[model samples]
Target: MDLLGNGPHVRQARRDAYREEDSLRTRRDRFKGFTNITTGSKGEGLTCCFKSDSDVMRVIDNVMCVEDGVNCNNISREITFMILNFRYYYHGHCKLRLGRRDQFIHPFVRRALWNDEYLSKE
Candidate 1:
């Protein structure tokens, strides 16, 4: 749909694969120019601590800047945007889709992406 004009460069996923750029805060999976999620309920936040590019860095910053007034913990919030994770080296993409009424992921899925039994079972 070309919703986003261009794909953002994800850092967290990149850092996991390769450690080339140490200057950027690789731990922050923030992309820049996320001006839309603020008005919506289905917002996104980055838990990973790796950053690869400027756009990502900015996005992460935007999420962190959310005020305490926003009650995001409420599951009623419908998260439409996908907070993606990417690294610079491997060019692999990992997207964490979040939705309201969804429970926390299983421990296995949270751990090794492959050892995650949920994926194998599927």
Candidate 2:
């Protein structure tokens, strides 16, 4: 079958021709897929990454910290993001609760971050 002879052949050829061009699109899709995970984003596609559950808890623990203490770039990344797992802090923050065996739901994990019950001592 010639590359562009029949209708089906033409369609297949077009798909194949664009596959290379769609590499960037494919990467974007895979990147977007990461948000589907519990350790991933629970809200919309747009998000700002935090450091750790404990860190988030620390901020939420203090209503004042949540406001007067800006958690923006001004704050030290090491202090704001110092989590139980150094590896996770080094890599990327996930939804794993410290000293627990289960993975909490994405939203709940985010919520637990505000709760002192889930906060790690360290």
lDDT scores in order: 0.32, 0.34
lDDT of 1: 0.32
* Cα-based TM-score, every candidate: 0.17, 0.20
Highest TM-score among the candidates is held by which one? 2
TM-score of 2: 0.20
For residues 1-64, what per-residue lDDT tens digits would candidate 2 score against the true structure?
A: 3443435555455444344334544455563432111222212212222422311111111111
The C-alpha stretches of model 2 lying farther than 4 A from their native spots are 1-6, 34-122
lDDT measured at residue 107 in model 1 versus the true structure, 0 to 100? 38
Question: Across residues 94-120, which tens digit of lDDT does each residue of candidate 1 receive?
Answer: 544322225444333335345544345
Prediction 2 global C-alpha lDDT:
0.34
Model 1 spans > 4 angstroms off? 1-76, 99-122
> Judged by lDDT, which candidate is best?
2
The all-Cα superposition gives candidate 2 an RMSD in Å to the true structure of 16.5
